[model samples]
Target: TELQEIAPKEFEGRIKRQGVVNALDDEDFAAAVRETGRKKLIIAGVTNDVCTVYPTLTALQLGYDVQVVADAGGSPTKMADDIAIRRMENAGATITSTVQLLAELAENWTSERGGKIIPFVMGLMPQQ
Candidate 1:
């Protein structure tokens, strides 16, 4: 419900939606990931501790590679956020900034797709 509500209209027909009542117990999530036939995941959620951490831990347990976007995940406090990030890292999930995530996805600055990606990614930079 929340996923559908929050997803942009442009992605309506294209994106798959799954509900996790408690991420730790969400079998559907694992099923969906397996359905993709991809082992790597880039994850972010509304709350860093419970929302993000639970799913990440589960993914690790299921043998999928995981990366969490620190800036995109939120927590009740900075301390909580730090703790969650450390926990994920200790559990073997790579913690990354959104910029790094985008850059990795774009792969190269000189490529044709990078021409589009680089500008959008650069727009996210902080002004000097």
Candidate 2:
């Protein structure tokens, strides 16, 4: 998974790797958000089949708005990826790019978060 690639050995620290769960099924993701005390959540994983669909569907069912980082999360094949995106989108999930998430998290360009984020953006940008 990309998360593992990004931070090898550290990914498991934050992920509850049950390898997909009934807890992530439609009604449960909502209860999870309420229980965790955080309105904001970032959902991502491999294989759009279960990882993306189950949790996204669950999160939406729970009334917790979700921001799915499509670029950060991907499926096994291009077709599988496209299908997953379309399926989730039809289910009212809003798909987003990795950069979009950073921008959204920052929320405003004139604030302190924005000022502090330029370097991170610069690092992510490809060399011209």
C-alpha lDDT score of every prediction, in listed order: 0.82, 0.71
Candidate No. with top TM-score: 1
Taking the tens digit of each residue's C-alpha lDDT, what string does model 1 give over 70-125? 88878999999999999999999999988898889889888887777898688899
**CA-RMSD of model 2:** 4.1
Off by over 4 Å in 2: 1-15, 21-32
Clashes of each: 0, 0
* Candidate 1 global CA lDDT score: 0.82
- Candidate 2: minimum summed lDDT over ten consecutive residues — where? 14-23
TM-score of each: 0.80, 0.72
**Pairs clashing within candidate 2:** none
lDDT of 2 by residue, 52-74 (tens): 67778777776767767787767
TM-score between model 1 and native: 0.80
How does residue 100 of candidate 1 score in lDDT? 93
